[model samples]
Target: MNSATPLLEVEGLRKSFAGVHAVDNMSFSVAHNTITGVIGPNGSGKSTTIDCISGFQRPNAGRIRLDGRDITRLTPQKIAKAGLIRTFQTVHIYEAMTLRENLLQAARPFQASGWVADFLRLPGMRREVDAAMVRADELVDMIGLRKYYDAPTRILSYGQKKLVALAAGLMPKPRLLVLDEPVAGVNPTRIREIEEVILNLHAAGESFIIVEHNVEFVMRLCERVIVFVGGSKMTEGDPKSVQQDARVLEAYLGIPA
Candidate 1:
């Protein structure tokens, strides 16, 4: 890929369920090593757009490119293997597993060997598992979950679970991480923690596309913001300009700019 090429691009994207259009003629791009925010009113197709981009839902018409290669028709698993991973609004962690175990499972997808080696516990497989454990511990420490490393995920608070999910998404070292509402229901402190994690990751050269309803949070976190209304892009710009746009304020915040 060229240095100037976008990390991810969506062109003329469209999706519909039954007769209702969810994402209509949407288009955007996420640059490398940048945090881009997507915000809109309810039913404005924010989630739908993400689903299409991440391969959770197939678009009726559009082109999706990752690192300059077409990935519009790839399966979710294939797309993930291609270094694009996403996390949902609901934290999806193994309730009965420890944080370390959860992180290990997330790393399983990137394992070079097949399950046959893992099942047999071969020397190479054991070495791989050990290395994965070390990586998991590093991730746990990075996300500030080292204190609960051995605790069952069920015992952690909701916000902590969100952190675990975020860390899990990073386990594969994806080029782009699509986060769906990273701090939707967390407390203020946890929200700040999540924000800090995002900023830290961005600083470390990870790219992100954040879909959030928290306008203030988006303003504080994202460099570029895209506003959606009626299943299409209303406007896009820097955080300040997007927030100050009359169309964005009216369509997204239900207030005049």
Candidate 2:
């Protein structure tokens, strides 16, 4: 693990609404090629924190860095270009678009094709399309949604839609992917599948910051787990240690023992 420079870092982040602080002086870091899990109860600021990181919502105060460059106030599009991608708790997929089309669209921003080239059907545009198609195929298969590659996403189940969103995020091959509640409403079997998909991606050198409500899922999947309570980071450590923390049990996650 590269300890000198983290892949992503957030320090002294603060967000508020109507005089209520959703995240107060939040701070953390995610190293390259490692998965870090963030867990907290409702209103603990897990989602709010990620929103700020991903540029969905601006923070009242803080610093966010990606690969040592500040991205605290950058737009979401700019942030994605800097190698950070995020998936929402609610699956965000084009219901009428074919799964393959959805994935390709997500990758368009990173492709070499310009608007002029695409409009003119230039060779560069075609080449980029071919490359994106290849990546789409790989991601679709990884998510076990190959059969739905040509099907409209609206026909998929809720869990299946979540998988599509995950795949779309991977199409960009981001430096860090933040997943918000990856398995929130998923069934046990679907959750297991999602776990396998994440493991496969991790083995291939992807880094992630997963903000999930499922304590067991986070514990089972992440190497390090950070617990949040009442909008601030309570503690962070290995999964086992975080799971056994008395404060975490009594406050957020229920006692496991």
Candidate 3:
């Protein structure tokens, strides 16, 4: 919460399954309002690291700080409530629901109304609904999904559905958004659109930690890149420097040293 503190920090993070270390003493920090990318090869602990940070998996030993507050042992729901939102590798939109409904549902947890109020349609509930709708409208427009606002998400293309998911994540205006493989299955053109959307959002004061297998995409979007190898941070620097590092080539890209 100090102006100079990193938005998120992980210190000596370590996790293992049956004695096999997934993230071994990894330490990293994501600066506020900056796009940071994490890239690694197979079995390099990328998945486990994010899982620990996001609270899906607890670390055997480590500390995770968000907004300069310790959140290392919080539950997934608690962590989400703390404003560290993470999207999955797969699309998470509700196919049967309209695009508008999906975005509104994403904010249900933050509405400050109890189920009794919601069921009875109380004044507070109604006011929250109106406010959520305004946010939904802004986000739908931002993601360029306004035309499909009332339409069921089931009919949208895979790329379009992904966009809907992105918009839903923004509905809460989280302190930091951790994107997991956002462009993994998206097409080339859609990838560019996603990139532009991220840049626009960053310009508007949003920060992100992107975990992606697509090195080229990460290089284009992130200000700093961290390469993981042997379950720890192998090297970290600007995209150009990380890309040219021989260790990254040998360890991540599978090119012989």
TM-scores of all candidate predictions against the true structure: 0.96, 0.96, 0.97
Candidate 2 TM-score to native:
0.96
What lDDT tens digits, residue by residue, belong to model 3 across residues 34-149?
99999999889988998999999999999999989999999988998999998888888899999999999999998799989988999999999999999998888888888999
RMSD in order of candidates = 1.3, 1.7, 1.1
Put down candidate 1 lDDT per residue, 23-118, tens digits, no spaces: 899998889999999999999999998888889999999999999989999999999999999999888889899998899888888888788887
Best by lDDT, which number? 3
Tell me the spans in candidate 2 whose CA falls farther than 4 Å from its real position: 1-3, 254-257
Model 2: per-residue lDDT, tens digit, 1-257?
Answer: 34588998899999999999999989888888898999888989998998999999999999999988899999999999988999999889999999999999999999877889989999999999999999998898889988888999999999999999999999999999999898989999999999999999999999989898788899899999988888889899999988778888877846553
Residue 129 error, candidate 3, Å: 1.1
Displacement of the residue 209 alpha carbon in candidate 1, Å: 0.6
TM-score quality measure for candidate 1: 0.96
Q: How many clashes in candidate 2?
A: 0
